[model samples]
Target: MQFIEFKKEHFIHDEKTGNYSLEIPKDEIGFGDVRLQKKQDDGSLAKIDAEIIDDLKQIKIILESPQDIRVNF
Candidate 1:
């Protein structure tokens, strides 16, 4: 239950679209407790959906939501 800043090396941002791609540790998604949240203008967090692809060692989160803002996991 850690809040990761979007500026870290764990993510990729798409400037053309309001979306992001992130890579995380395999253990982080254990039991499917992973949840995606986007930062709102009011400095609050908003829930967003993502496409998580579990590769062998890491999990790839392909965010489908069009939100070009800070996010936490």
Candidate 2:
């Protein structure tokens, strides 16, 4: 199966803050905050902390997972 990947231009990283920012236009994802969850070892999802910037235009995520992530993204 194939999955949709985020556009290259949408991914941004702030070197100073060690934060990964994803640029989502209001038209694509709406003008609201997006909830992100990380899959746990037990096959459950846990809410991960993230920061929203410029409304829905940007979302900052710090991936600190000790193991490899298997996100559906």
Candidate 3:
């Protein structure tokens, strides 16, 4: 298991909406072991929603939880 930092080339950033979309390789997910978290001011992680792409070998994550949050997975 590896923690990969998201890069610009990793996904599509919509200039109009100012949203980021990321795709994770399905192989990297062991038994669908994936999570979404939003960092809090108290240094805590809050779980968020993540969309899974069943047709493709990847998972799609949209960064739209909280503006002051540093979202991670």
Candidate 4:
């Protein structure tokens, strides 16, 4: 299976409060403060945790160029 691993900042670091510090912009509902997101097979964006990314080093393929992926505000 292929997956898009986002950078660490997008995940919620504070487990106790479960609060994601990044501020969300008013124009975008779930993406205002997000630094990165994973693109699902169905073309949906899912919120990802930084820890998951850290553990993904064992089994990830690095792409030389962008294919069908795009990030926009």
Candidate 5:
């Protein structure tokens, strides 16, 4: 399997049915804690905690003051 960093175009869900959908931002990388958006009935999004998939690699967050958050792939 190939490693893919989470992108804005990626959709995350706890279940395969996708009853709940979360949109990730392109500039953001999976790290310590992340807030996700849930697709709603009105076609709007709501804030929810994102669930990390077991198959995906856990990204490490490196804190470097005044720099963008680094994620190890």
Candidate 6:
């Protein structure tokens, strides 16, 4: 079996909230908020919490199981 994974990152600026919104991809399966920050002198991302919104579409896959297979002799 083989599967493909796709991801897209978008930055949303809201004047009312005064924060940046992270929009996840529509075809991916994971959605959540992640912290992002500028790199410090030690080259580590700062601890900044950012909201991640998800607008994903439905995904469907069909596979043939062993019980569904039939053989004719």
What TM-scores do the predictions have?
Answer: 0.54, 0.47, 0.52, 0.24, 0.26, 0.32
lDDT of 2 at 36: 55
On TM-score, the leading prediction is 1
In Å, residue 22's CA in model 6 sits off its true spot by 1.8
**Which structure is stronger by lDDT: 2 or 4?**
2
Give a tens-digit lDDT track for model 6, residues 18-47.
554433343443333322333344654443
After TM-score superposition, what is the CA distance of residue 68 in candidate 3 from its true location, in Å? 9.9
lDDT of 1 by residue, 17-37 (tens): 766687777665453445567
Please name the candidate that would achieve the greatest lDDT relative to the true structure.
1
Candidates sorted by lDDT, descending order? 1, 3, 2, 4, 5, 6
Q: 1-73, model 5: which lDDT tens digit per residue?
A: 1123333333333354534333333344434444334445575555434333422444322111111111222
Error of 3 at 55 (Å): 3.7
Worst 10 residues of 4 by lDDT: 52-61
Q: C-alpha displacement of 35 in model 2, angstroms? A: 2.0
> Which ranges in model 1 have alpha carbons more than 4 Å from their true place?
7-20, 27-32, 65-73
Q: Candidate 3 — what's its lDDT?
A: 0.53
Q: lDDT for each of the candidates?
A: 0.61, 0.46, 0.53, 0.34, 0.33, 0.30
User: lDDT tens digits, residues 1-73, model 2?
Assistant: 2122343344466778665555545555454445555456696667655554555354334443222122232
Error of 2 at 15 (Å): 1.6
Error of 3 at 29 (Å): 1.5
- Candidate 4 lDDT over residue span 5-60, tens digit each: 43434433455655433322333322222233556679777544432111211212
Candidate 4 clash pair list: 25-32
Worst 10 residues of 2 by lDDT: 64-73
